[model samples]
Target: MFTGLIENLGVIDSFESDRFTLSVLNTSTTSILSTASVGDSIAVDGVCLTVESFTDNSFTVTVSPETLQRTTLSEKIKTTNYVNLESSLCVGSKLGGHFVTGHVDGIGSLVNYISTNKAWEMTFAAPSSKIQEWSNFIEPYLITKGSIAVNGISLTIAECDVSGNWFKVSVIPHTYAYTNLHYLRPGDLVNIEGDILGKYVEKFLSSTLKSTKDRQSNINSDFLAEQGYQ
Candidate 1:
């Protein structure tokens, strides 16, 4: 689990097949190397990846084929890209941001960016979420003023289309400058994770409704026996 708060900006070192290596650019290398161990989970751009190896300045993780198909990491690997990094949440620490699972649901495209006097209002167009898939579940939980994790940065949805495929977020200058959002361009893809709480509620409601419908339509032998019905 994570808090959606970025801890460091890492320079993409190399992506050779399954090996994804990154080096600390602005953050302290010695501190990270000393603390982080192999098998520790790290969130790279909202994707939870396990640390396979590390050095004073760089670390490597193995990316699964599923991750490559679901996230923007494959694209990030093509060029020299800076990715947002956040360590797993520690117990007893302040929850600065909403609970983030570092599980990318799917990819979203930046549609537009408008600079307001106080913040940056950005619009994104997520793919249609008719079924449950990463990047395909946004519609169920894309609520206005609800939390979302985009590229591992926690943000609140300022507005959302009723269809749920498009949404807007308000980004303060501090958030824009500190994280990788500053490097974003229109049409660029980003990893997205909706609020977990919303997902849970959606699942619960769906299950309850389905169960009710099934019970109404089908006769259950156990239920009939309990009710003394032949």
Candidate 2:
């Protein structure tokens, strides 16, 4: 698990098929590699990746086909070399941000961005070509004022439509300057992970409703006997 608080920015050094190497740019106060070790899980652009090997400034991880299909890593590597990095949460570490699983649901693209006096308001939505995928995996969980992890940066939904077609986040100056969000342009792809708590609640509610409806529809003497009702 992660807190969606970006620790460092990394530059994609090389990507050969599945092997990926990232050079950590320790621009932040904390360094991801300082306490990292082989097999450690790191959130790379909101995708949980394992450290296969490491050095003082760089580390390698293998990207599986599923990760590639579900995230923007492949497109990000081609369009930009920068990515947000965050190490997995330690037991006693302060929970600075919302709970982030580092499991990207699907890819979204920057719809637009505007600079406000105090923050940068950025809007994101499903790419036109992949709206179905976004609807299935992402849209259901988006709620106004809810927490979301975009490219592994914890942010709250400043605004969103009831349909969940798009959402906007207000990024403060510190986050804009520190993370890879500064490099994004309109239509740039980003990895998106909805709040884990919301997903669990949705699952529980769905299952409960389904079971209730099934029991109601199957109401009969035989069903009562099976359920051990006298």
Candidate 3:
């Protein structure tokens, strides 16, 4: 679990078929390498990648094909300079942002970005159809004021299209300057993870209702007579 608060910027040193290495590129927060150890979970662009090995200024993780297919990590290897990095939430740590599982549901793209006095209004076009190439899951449950993670950065939805094709977020200057969102272009794809809480609730309710209907007992006249209720 993570709070979606970016801790540092990691410059990708190398990306291969299964391995990804990055340096401890920090801007404001404490460098993760200061305390991170092997097997520690790190959110690299919204995907929870376990640290396979490390050095004073660098760390590595072995990525799976499924993760590569679902996140922007592969696309970013050829484009993005720095990737957003965040440490997992601790027991007593501050929860500045929403709960981010670091599980990328699908990839979305930037539709537009505009500067505003209050905040930078940024819009993203979500994947509409299930692209089997990816995890093939694009269920947008984002409500107005609900939280969403884009490239591992938790943000609140400002305006979402009813069709779930796109949504907007108002990012403050601090957030914009610190994370990899600054490196995004209009068409750049981002790792997207919907709020886990909402997803679970939706699943629970749907399953509960389905099971209830499946187990419905029909009380016909013949059944009532057999039960001595006629």
Compare the candidates by TM-score and give the number of the best one: 2
lDDT of 1 by residue, 175-209 (tens): 89878898989988899999999999999999999
> Which has the greatest lDDT?
2
lDDT of 2 by residue, 136-182 (tens): 98999999889999999999998999899999999999999999999
Candidate 1 matches the true fold with a TM-score of: 0.88
By summed lDDT, the worst window of 10 consecutive residues in model 1 runs over 127-136
Model 3 C-alpha lDDT per residue in residues 1-230, reported as the tens digit of each score: 99989999888888877998898775864788888988899999889999999998899999999888767788767863788898888899999999999988888878799988868899987544434422335444767899999889989999887766678999999999999898887977888888898888888998999999899687888899999995
Candidates' C-alpha lDDT? 0.86, 0.92, 0.84
Off by over 4 Å in 1: 27-34, 127-135, 217-230
Candidate 2 vs candidate 3: the TM-score winner is: 2
Full-model lDDT, candidate 2: 0.92
The window of 10 residues in a row where model 3 has the poorest summed lDDT is 127-136
Off by over 4 Å in 3: 127-136, 220-230
Colliding pairs, model 1: 105-134, 105-135, 106-134, 106-135
